[model samples]
Target: MSIITTERLCKYFKGKKALDNLNLEIPKGIIFGYLGPNGAGKTTTIRVLLNLAKPTGGTAYILGEDIRKSRNYLRKVGFLPDVPNFYNFFTAREFLSFIADITDIENPKKRIEETLELVGLRNEKSRIGTYSRGMKQRLGLAQALLSDPELLILDEPTSSLDPQGRKEVLDLIYSLKSTKTVFFSTHILSDVERICDRIGILKEGRLLLEDSIENIKKRYWKRRILIEVDDLEKFLERIKESLKPNSVEVKNSSVVIEVLDIQYTLKEIPKIVVQDGLLLEKLEILEPSLEDIFLEVTSGA
Candidate 1:
């Protein structure tokens, strides 16, 4: 089941198109990474989906209810913006208690205790003012999950944290996948690679690609072979004419080449090396990374 759907959803700001005819669907019970470089309308899309900003064209549905027509979906979602605010002077338990009272949650004490424990802040008694940035982020997550909303919307959740803090927050998000559908939006490729099952790449307010991480990588997979030889100069001259590869570069001891035909290159390189009387030191296939895929698709393809 789709937890979120957008059909030709668009948002314009002061004669600029922030989102242009975006069509997206996020399935239930998975971490959906909304990836893009800066000014790619990631935040704009989130705002429209949350109904925080009205779209200039088209519409969206969250939790199966049309966002334009019903507000019932809002309560089913929890949001954590890039920068989360807190009552600096309030204790973790105190602040959550206050939120619970305002929201009329039953058995606030038990729920608050469980959430704090889940976020690794159960025993923490320090006032929020005394907390570190990481601690504050944990508290913010505790607040967001206190309601136990079905879908969690996070914007750059770890962009501002130190290495340790980023790990802590990411671990927390990864742990919630079975219980909540996480809509994770960020430009940090490594983080997305770590926890996201699926990703949608956006550029200039248009979604360029959306698929499972493995499938996307496979579809864009180009063979990159690292070949090291005794005669670098001679092999370079011969291979260009014979292999006709997409690209070839010398990196330290190895010459990395993206081959057009893996079978041909693998079979032909040995013969060329023998003909050129060059020593074949090493020949290995290099794996494609998410960064490589992101750059390739966003740049043109």
Candidate 2:
């Protein structure tokens, strides 16, 4: 069953459509990536799903229950916003204990200790003010997990962190895939590529594509063949007339050809090169990266 579902979900602000006719189904136990550029209505969608902002049109459901109907479902959901605030005066343990109490968690002390350990803050006795940005981010995650939520919705979780910090947080997020459904929304393409099982790309308030990472790669695979030859200009001219590939470009000491049919191109290109008596040093097909697909789809290029 889908852990989250939305149908024609929309939100507007001052005559601007933040979310437009969005339809999505996020299955349980998968790390789902919600990707888009800034102002692409990513945060707006999250707000609507949490009922923090009322949808101007359509509806959203969490765990098969409509968010507008009741807020009870929130108990089972954990959220880590892009920017999380904390009381600088409070220590890590103190802050977690406070959150536990507010949430009416049973045995708040034990839960706080467990959560501290889970986020690698077990030995932390310093006030939040003394914690590094990365530590604070981890603490934010610990607070979100305090209630043992089934669904964890994270917005730009690694936004401003250093490479080391980003790796640390991403590792923590990866560890949760076995136990929780993660809805990770970010513009970081590499992070999505690394951890997301499925992804949905949003552009100008609309969902342009949604599918498993593997499926997307296959579906949008660009058959680009890169050929390195002894004479770049000669090979470029020969292929332009003989091969008639979809597109051709001269790059430094090599020629790049984009073909519609990989099988045909692979068979035909070599034969043409051999016939021309030109030295073919290296030839390989180039796989399209997620960033390549994202730019093409979002920019409509």
Candidate 3:
């Protein structure tokens, strides 16, 4: 089931369009990566979904309930905004306890301790004012999940973390995916690639593409064959004769070929390589990454 959806969603600021006629469906119980460059409207879309901000035109739904009408639905969602503010005077444990109290949660001491450990900040019992930016972000995440929410909306979830801190948070977020739905928005493509089951690429306030990781790679990116042939001239000639025009390029005694059908190319490549008496030093298919797809879609080049 689709836990989050937006239909022709549009959000305008004064006269500027931040989100334009956007349509998206995020499946339940899966990590949906919302990707875009800065000012691409990723945060705007998220805000609308949470009902933190109203949309100018169109509608949004979360957990099958209209976002505008379902104020109580917020209880089922955990939100970590790009920048999370807190009472710095409060210690880590105290801050968590405050949230638990406001949410009317029972037995919050145990829950607070559990969440603190879950974020790998169990040892930091000092005031939050002394914590690092990364620690604050982790604390924000801990608070978001304190309710044991069914849906998590995270914006730049790892933006403030060091490598180790980021990894710890990511591991925690991934662990939660088994039981909760996550909508992770970030400009960091690598993070999305690591944890996202499906991704939507938004650019200039519009969703340019939305698809599974596998489907995006298959549709816009393909595996390439890199071959090292013994006789450069002969190998080049044979490839030209046997392969489609402009498909093969010879570079430094290595031939890189772009083929539409990987299986057919694999079958035919060995024959051509052998006939040309190539060394076969390295023959492998290399697929494109999410970064590659992101550049292609956003640049319009």
Against the true structure, what is each candidate's TM-score?
0.90, 0.92, 0.94
What lDDT score belongs to each candidate, Candidate 1 first? 0.90, 0.89, 0.87
Tell me, by lDDT, which candidate is best. Answer: 1
If ranked by lDDT, best first, what sequence of candidates would result? 1, 2, 3
Per-residue lDDT value at 115 in model 3: 93
**lDDT tens readout by residue for model 1, 22-62:** 99999999999999999999999988888889999999889
Query: Model 3 — which ten-residue stretch has the worst lDDT?
Result: 239-248
Write down the worst ten-residue block by lDDT for model 1. Answer: 74-83
CA RMSD of all predictions: 2.3, 2.0, 1.8
| Candidate with more favorable, higher lDDT: 2 or 3 | 2
Positional deviation of residue 28's Cα in model 3 after best superposition, in angstroms: 1.1
| Candidate 3: segments with Cα more than 4 A from true spot | 230-233, 250-253
Candidate 3 residue-wise lDDT, 1-301, digit = tens: 8998889999999989999999999998999999999999999998898887999999988888888777777889999989887899998888889889988778998999899988878889798989888888998999999999999999999987888888888888899889999999999898999898999999879999999999999887655778876676777677667766347767787878887677877888789877666676778786888998999989982
Error of 1 at 138 (Å): 1.3
Which pairs of residues clash in candidate 1, taking residues 3 or more apart in a chain or in different chains? none
Name the candidate that leads on TM-score. Answer: 3
